[model samples]
Target: MRATIAPQDPADNSDWDVDGSPPDVVIKLSCPNAQPAPPSEEVESFTPAWTQGACDVLSTDLLSAPIQFSVIDVDALFDDPIVSVQYQVTRADIDRGVMEFTGSGALRSVAFQLTTYYAE
Candidate 1:
């Protein structure tokens, strides 16, 4: 699934920079081999840790400004579910763009993962 940035946070926002320059970037998440059905409650609880790790990895790059991640789509195939998550990083959030992890079991398998996209 492909998720485009919302109009409210268009990719061309001039203000999306700390140094008055927009970073060329795009953020994407894919769960290709994920189980079709939701993971058990026990397994679901560990999602936060996984998200935290991803956030840490994303934040390490100084080029990319921190952006918040949001769920944009989810497709459940016969074997695995294709989850598409999106994030929008604004200039305003650059300074305060701390990585945050959030998920919902009801949506199935800790749906909705997000992080900021930065320039390479």
Candidate 2:
């Protein structure tokens, strides 16, 4: 699978150092039934992690098992949770071409664009 991630944090930049210093987001995935997905991505504020490829869903119960996306800030000294969201991927959505979704956490929201197949 391929996906894009974007930060929808509060627009107030007064407290943030806007000279290209924003929280670097680390994207991680987990499923109830297998080893975690590989090639976790990192994205900057408002910047999308574009079209990440080749995610294999190994669970037998693909519909019932949830796929979780965890967003973390890598710039922090310690582990910081920015957002955690989960959705069950169904075969119908996969065959429909592309999927778009959004999720909100305590600090901000995120927008995602997903595609299973790679194309020019």
Query: Which lDDT tens digits does candidate 1 get at residues 15-106?
Result: 32333332222223322222122222211111222222233233334234333333321113221122334444434444564423343321
The ten-residue window of minimal lDDT in model 2 covers: 1-10
What TM-score do all the candidates reach, one by one?
Answer: 0.26, 0.59
CA lDDT, candidate 2, residue 96: 61
Residue pairs in collision within model 2: 1-55
Quote the positional error of residue 103 for candidate 2 in Å: 3.1
User: What Cα-based lDDT does every candidate model obtain?
Assistant: 0.29, 0.52
Q: List pairs with backbone clashes in candidate 1.
A: 64-118, 64-119, 67-116, 69-114
RMSD of 1: 16.3
